[model samples]
Target chain A: MLEFILARGNYWVIVALMMTGLYISFSAQNLIKRLVGLSVFQTSVFLFYITLGKVAGGTAPILIGEDLAGHHGAGHEEDAAHGTAAAGHEAPVETPAAPHVETEPVVEVDPETGEPIADPTAIDPAAELAPDAVDPGHSDIPPLQGEDASLMGEPLEDGVTETSDYVLSGHDGAADALHQAAESSLHSVYSNPLPHVLILTAIVVGVATLAVGLALIVRIREAYGTIEADEVRNIDIDVALEEEEAEDAAAEGAA
Target chain B: MNPDHHVILRVVAKTLIPLITLYAFYVQFHGDYSPGGGFQAGVIFAVGIILYALIFGVSSALRLIPPSFTRGLAAAGVLLYAGVGIWALFGGGNYLEYGALLDEPEGGHHGQHIGIILIELGVLFGVAGSMLTIFYAFAGRVAEISDEDW
Candidate 1:
């Protein structure tokens, strides 16, 4: 149970932040303080959304030319230019040691020209890759977390799953390991960008709400001469009472 | 807001403002290739303006971008978006179907690119203007808060 909680610690943080923000928002009497609390709550929601989009062994979903191998994000063109950089390398280990790739091409023939295409199967790197060996990084990951399981159908090796930093780690495994690592990096999962894009709009809306709420608070303070909710209510009550007394006097005069 | 109030801040802002604006534009344009897009870029641009207002009072900032202009910017942005959608309709496609804008068989991708750029541009203008307008509305007010309030 502890391991499960630890694995998804980000959720805990989101919950904590949400509760704290809610507490402050509900309990605070001052209008500005309430706004601050609301902002905090909004921030927690943003964190929650962004967290949901994250994948354990993912990169940004930018397409590198015709590779469709790994997503290279905008402005990070260098990432696609330098292949296998997604391997999370400590040094400049290019192509996960390119010469060691032991590729068995799946052959196909073109229908129209009757020409042979050289190994189009190489384009789809993830079709044959599977967890034949224990993936050390994901061995402890809870099976309940369908996030990782759905991606590679197993815990991946360092080149794909282990490195958070955009890649290259030289594992001096045999040629088979090298081949697996190279192919895996290209097919590595990407964090879902849909949530990220949606959250951007959410953030803007949050700010707009904050701005409008704060502006209303300022107007309230100007009119009521206090920022405290109770004080404003008390002032309103006093004015209502005075009006009632005046009405009573007028009725008495008419009588 | 006085010129002598914070010399250091003024100098730093003078140096940083241009870069911030440039970065906002970069984020807006390169949003397709990266994490950022219209909404993110719009917020960044607004932050730059808000930063300026923070250092040099609301009135000073308002001089640079009048409230009317911001309002116009917001309206124009919305109109631009609607205009593009209408244009697509004229091209005999569904509402906002960018591919219909061009007559070419292979024009779908190019049309999509253009449509997305225009939409993003609209979003940028609308968000930036609305944010600035809200900021101005709040900051233009003269609130008297005593030190005891703290």
Candidate 2:
């Protein structure tokens, strides 16, 4: 439980921020104070999303073409070796160093043209070319491999580009430790793009709401002569009481 | 507001306003590549104008940008945004389908860029105009109430 809490400390901070903002928004008597609390609440929510999007050691999602090219070259050799091994080249199948990678799904190929179909399930070639490896500085580890090219209906070198490429692919025994590190970096650690995009729209909407709210407050102040919530409530209550009393008096006269 | 105001403040404000305006435009255009976009740029532009109004009376600011014009510009901005979507629909694509605007297949990417720029410009105009209008409405009433009344 301690480890779980420690691992998710960011969530705790988010909860604290949310609770503080909520408390202030509900309990604050001043209308402006309440608005401030609302803004604080919005800010906390933004922080929550941004925190959720953070990868442990991941860089910004933007890809550099030069880096991808470099990774692409390194990946090709590993892919070829894996292809040959899978084709019964008598190469050692198991690497002593690297953890065994479950064979990934092969790309479907059209038999007529001997070309790979654009499989949506395949990680984008661009994304595959991306140094998705967590430690970008350490280039010594080989690219992770996709299925052997021979396994697909077409030749690996001609049709398969991204799927066959992997870090430390053939040198399973030699690069096993690095492969595990890369594997850890590949899966659980990446940021989700959805929240980032969603929050962009949310922020604009939030600002629009804030602007309208402030405008309404200004109009309210002009009509009531005070912005205090207590004062405004009292004024409204007095007007309601006057209406009720007038209605009662009118009813009595009618009777 | 006075012609004989503190020389330093007047000079500093004069220097800063142009820079702020330039930065707002930069943010507007550079938004595609960077962190800022139409909403941010609009707010910055409004802030620059509001700062001017604070240093030099509201009347001076109003003279620069009349409230009537601001109101119209706000509506125009919204119309522009909607117009782009309509234009795309008329071009035989779904609403706001930027690719449909590309006459040539090779221009598909460029067409999307054009659509984004147009909408962002609309957002800029709407946000800046409305913000200024709101400021004008609020400031115009200051004469009726004295500071001590608060």
Give lDDT tens digits, candidate 1, residues B1-150: 356889999889988887888889999998755667777787789889988888877787889889898888888878877888888788775577666566436313566567778888888888888878887777765567642553
Model 1: residues >4 Å from true position, as ranges? A57-189, A248-255, B1-5, B54-57, B143-150
Per-candidate Cα lDDT values, in order, are: 0.59, 0.59
How would you class the docking of model 2?
A: incorrect
RMSD of each: 12.8, 14.1
**TM-score of model 1 relative to the true fold?**
0.64
lDDT of 2 by residue, B36-120 (tens): 7788888889889988888887888999988998898888889988888988777666677665555436324555677778888
Tens-place lDDT digits, model 1, residues A14-87: 88889989999989999888888888898888887776555444443222233233221121223234333122
Q: What is the lDDT of candidate 1?
A: 0.59
The CA lDDT at B104 in model 1 is: 34
